[model samples]
Target: MTQLKQIKLIAFDLDGTLVDSAPDLALAINAMLVDLGRSEFSEQTIRHWVGNGAEVLIKRALSGTSVIAEDLDEALYLKAKPLFNRHYSERLCVASKLYQGVGESLAALAELNIPMAIVTNKPGLFTQPLLEQLNLARYFDVVLSGDSLARKKPDPLPLQHLVEHYQLNIDQLLMVGDSKNDIQAAKAAGCASLGLTYGYNYGEDIALSGPEFVADSLETLVELMNGSVTA
Candidate 1:
């Protein structure tokens, strides 16, 4: 294991990392499919499609597969996007909840006076309402959604923007998330990252992403953040 270091601003990916929003997203996607007279997807299938954003989720759900092709019909995709958004807005948080120990970990971080932010591929509309419903909004000083900027995760724009706006040292920031995009963004932005094994990794092992640490649970992540784990 790499040596753990002191962290200042801890940025998180919202959907898979902090909140298990797959249920709600599945509900909405299946509803859209049913409306279109297409087959509905299973919750487990939807779970694998998440973390890439709603548009990607919608595409994956509608196609009945996770594989995306560039030659897909733009007209049909544009038509389906709004339907998914509408259904999702109504069903947001109906089944979503904070992952185990998430609330406690956030509170503990607050008590320690550590700054935090949400950096997720979820759109602002869904992210804000879901966090508000889960009562997790107050824990973050900043919430950078997928649509917040022109580029999303894997581009390093969000992390760069956060580091610049908050006047934080790049090395002092840590990215906690559950997918390749998160790890890539952290690496591109010159920050350390911790991956959650329990979160969505799109059927791939998170270890291949090369996060500095891989935590089995939020409690374990809190321990690492609190310096309980020896470097």
Candidate 2:
């Protein structure tokens, strides 16, 4: 557990960590593909293409494989981006849902009076909508989308922004997410990270990223954080 006694603030990643957003994302991806006169892949296939923001998600969908095509047409990509956005906005909460125990877990954390925020690479437009749709918006004090800052995850700017916003040392913040981007950002920001096993991690295990703790569910996380020293 590495004895995470110094954690003062917790920053969560939106897409994978809290919500299983792949089904709706796949619908949006397939809609974009159909617009471009291409065949669509299954939700499972599209699930692996997530983790990065919508731009890369569209790029991977256009490539039709895990490895994004090197020859994707720039103009065509420009067309696909807006198409995906429109389609995603329409079905923002259609098949998307909060992962099990998210609400109760967040409430548990709140009971501890721990400050929390959301730091995600999902775009600003889609991020808040999804949270409000799932009723998860009330739990966070700060929400930073990909476009909210100069840079997003894997760059540490989002986490760094949180560290600055709360007036805490970076080490006192703990990041919780399912992707390497989250862990990488936390490591770069000199904070602790808790990796979840259930979210999209590009078909690889989140534990491979070497977070301070790897959990299969958020229920345990409440226990993990509740038992840790806050003072």
Candidate 3:
């Protein structure tokens, strides 16, 4: 693994990175499908469709595949969106859980006085609640949801915002996630990225994303960044 360059700010991706929200998301999606008189999908299938955003997750569910059809019916999508939102809102924390070592690792980092933030593609409506429910919100001062800015990950705007807001040099920010989207965004923003092997990455290997570092557990981060996400 390449050593991280003097990280002063660490930005985490929610959903797969910190919390395993698939069970709840799958349940809500199935509820929406049932309401729409459609067939319900399994949670495992739904897991492959996560990490993008709620809108795209719905699109994938409506289309029944990760590769959403360009000709997906907008009218049906219009109806499904609110249905999903309502269904999800009702069970936001029912089946969701923070990944193993997440809470402890975060607390460890907090003790180290490392400034942190969250830059997830999940919308603020869902993102904030999930964090609060899991008690992860206290670890971050700046939380940038998908809609917080005009652009989300893979666009680099959100991560860039963290750099600007924290007044840190581009090299001082570390974007940690489980998707190519996170690694891509960090590369675009000229920062470092750490990819986790256990999170949702479209069922692909996180190593393929070519991050500066890769670890199977969030605990490794606490070890790697004893005082820094650096050498």
User: How well is each residue in 96-168 modelled by candidate 2, as lDDT tens digits?
Assistant: 9889999889999999889999998899999998999899898899999989998889999999888888999
Q: Against the correct fold, how does model 1 do in TM-score?
A: 0.96
Give TM per candidate: 0.96, 0.96, 0.96
- Candidate 3 error regions (>4 Å): 1-5, 227-231
Order by TM-score, highest first: 3, 2, 1
Candidate 1 Cα outliers beyond 4 Å, as residue runs: 1-5
Model 3 lDDT per residue over 1-231, tens place: 434438898999998999999999999999999999999999999999998899999999999999999999999999999999999999999989989999999999899899999999898898888888888888999999999999999899998899999898999999999999999999999998889998788878998888988998888888888734444
The clash count for each model shown is 0, 0, 0
Candidates ranked, most accurate by lDDT first: 3, 2, 1
How well does candidate 1 match the true structure, expressed as C-alpha RMSD?
1.4
Pairing residues by index, what is the TM-score of model 2? 0.96
Model 1 residue 194 distance off true place after TM-score fit, in angstroms: 0.2
Q: Which candidate would rank higher by TM-score, 1 or 3?
A: 3
